[model samples]
Target: MAMQGTLLEFILGWLMIPWRIFVEIYRHAFPPANEAGEHEHEGMLDASSGDITIDKRELSHWTKLSQQWWDPEGDFALLHGFNHCRIPMILDAYSKYIAQKPLPDTNPLRGAKIIDVGCGAGFVSEPLREYGADITGVDMVPAVIELAKAHWNERHPTEIGPDYLCTSVEEISSQRPEEFDMVLCLEVLDHVANWKEFAAQSCRLLRPGGCAIFSTINRTLAALIIAIIGGEHLLRIVPMDTHHLRKFIKPSEVEYELNKHGLVQVNLTGCTPVDPWARRPRWSDVSYCGVTYAITAVKRA
Candidate 1:
């Protein structure tokens, strides 16, 4: 068994697929930009209300797995199990600020508005809604958004869930600038070519004093060894090509990029693949290292 695992890891590690092909495919899906650099086409992929970034292979890839998104131990299990750490990290970040009313039992985040950027099948958005947040989830993939919307409504028809959109953060932020209390880009930064633009969009979407939280992989030798060779190849926790080495950003990189976009880092913490305390063995972090982490940044007033 050990030899098999090692062999599998060795074979898969060599599968370092290039990301540019995916980018070119997406570009072909839309019209060429004119001299002004504006997208000549806007409605492709059902993102009529928004424009798309250059790299969007992740969207097209994940859209195929929409049916398994909500399954706890399925293809998206890493994200499913991550709720334990993610919810706590987000709540802890918000708890520091002073507010007029006391936290409500039913919805601690009542009256607050949150935008879940790159929300896959409404995983983060639906749960946040129970906390009384007026949530809006945006993703570049129209098919995934439709699937997520249908699933959310069918499961929680009575509950106030997120308003899911088939759009990019860039488009939505432009439409309603400086309008959210919090913006979350969980497990998404590494998948897009427009990370810097995404950071800028977060700043535009946030109200004065509003915050943005991002969870993504760190660029390190250890990360490539463990996350790629071990997780994707050997253990098969996530899909192959789920992570792109070129897209991984360092921790300081995120701080610096967001800072340049007028957002200040409040807190950052490392995360493991699953929560350790869960009865089932899952992903969780032992300490704040330079691995995978969650970062909270507040937009300046």
Candidate 2:
């Protein structure tokens, strides 16, 4: 009887395993409506060509990757994370840097020119306009640029249109070289296929003494587990392929590339992790915030 009971218990446990896995997947994929709905916005349409403009062949793959990284509600979530319900953390950091002193009379825009590369949804760039900065925001995705335009329009109803362009960094640099006082490529370097080349192109766009800020995940074991396994498979918080380990760059590696392109790192900061348990932001270094790293660099003369 003891042997028979043991066998039955083993069988029961084996049978329940699949159900447990299914339940876990369901919970992660579909969080409670109340929680998910909190991020939802009223119906907004893309003003740039109602249809997405990338080539059809590349559209599927780009869209798949984009669906993961480009959260339709990222602006809303970022506002909640950074203690400022108005702008993104990156922009908040820049604004804080500029607001340190009074703006110079000769130069407007907080005494600096700014360019926000990969300005997804204009979360970071829009705030700069209020400070009187000549900010230009660029992104490759038409759908995303459209969304950013719509958001910009809604926010600045009385102001002139945003200086937003849709193209790769290299393409833009080829057309207009040495133009910006400062360039921002936050959280976007890892997404591109050839970051070294892209970084070089980004450098060419900057004027002497101009600054370019960047943020991305560093390639490491912790990054892979948190960004891919936990973020995509477990949490279902971001679409799969949002972070490709092979494309991720280490801090030293980025510094080398920037140095090669005549840019030098001025500052570096570790970001606080996003708390899944609390469903909010928290100050931690456990790679819980998907191992993201932020860097500020200046162009060589």
Candidate 3:
């Protein structure tokens, strides 16, 4: 059995050599540009000018999947299962760092205002709302926002739920600067054209001392194989082209951007699937972050 396992490992390692070479060539051919020059040549720069983070390609891809946003057994099942771990991380961070008080057993987040950036069909927003949070779910995709609203309405016929908006985080920050207790940008950092600008705007939306939570896949060869090749191609978990290689940001890069915007890192945790087939993620150590990770930061007072 040991010999067989070793042979399998050797075979896999040999198979990955070609992918490693391709990654190197891709990186060298299209070297990451500085923040000022990033995506300028690709015609990806949004005309809206100041801190516009929307990527048209990404928008179109998500728009096509808007109808499947709430399907637990469909394309986004991995994301739906992600809520189990991310929700607790959000609550723990808020209670420990932002709230600084022991929360009540019921409605722990009662009266807490949260902005769910890139909130697709209210997946994260709906759960947080159930915990008594006042959530505003913002997404650039119109169809998903509508779906979110319809789903919320169906779920709560007598009571209102999260405020679903069809807009960008930059627009929201401009209108309601420093108003929220928490800003969540889960699975969104890699999708934006300009992550620095997106991080800045996300931080701007938070009130002083408020928490900002972000989750994204790391830029590494492991991520390339698992997230893009395996998940998108072999397993067909997420839609094709849902992620791009060049857009994935490293954890250190995220911390640097958030720190520049006056947000201090409080916690960083890695998340990965429980198994290849199940695809359900669980919180793990930072060492496992070569694939996917979540970070919590607090804006300075």
Highest-scoring model, lDDT: 3
Query: Model 2, range 76-159, lDDT digits (tens) per residue?
Result: 342234323213433444444544454444324654567787776576677677666778888877777777777778777778
Predicted model with the maximum TM-score: 3
Worst 10 residues of 3 by lDDT: 1-10
Model 3 TM-score (2 dp): 0.86
- Against the hidden true structure, what lDDT does model 3 obtain? 0.80
Residues 17-113, candidate 1, lDDT per residue (tens digit)? 2343344234435424531232322312323434444354565677777787877666676677778778866666666642433465677887878
lDDT of 1 at 130: 72
Order of candidates by TM-score, top first?
A: 3, 1, 2
Colliding residue pairs in candidate 1: 272-285, 273-283, 274-282, 274-283, 274-284, 275-283
lDDT, residue 104, model 3: 89
lDDT of the candidates, in the order given: 0.71, 0.59, 0.80
Per-candidate clashes, comma-separated? 6, 1, 0
Ordering by lDDT: 3, 1, 2
Kindly list the per-residue Cα lDDT of model 3 for residues 81-109, writing each as its tens digit. 78777888888888998789888889999
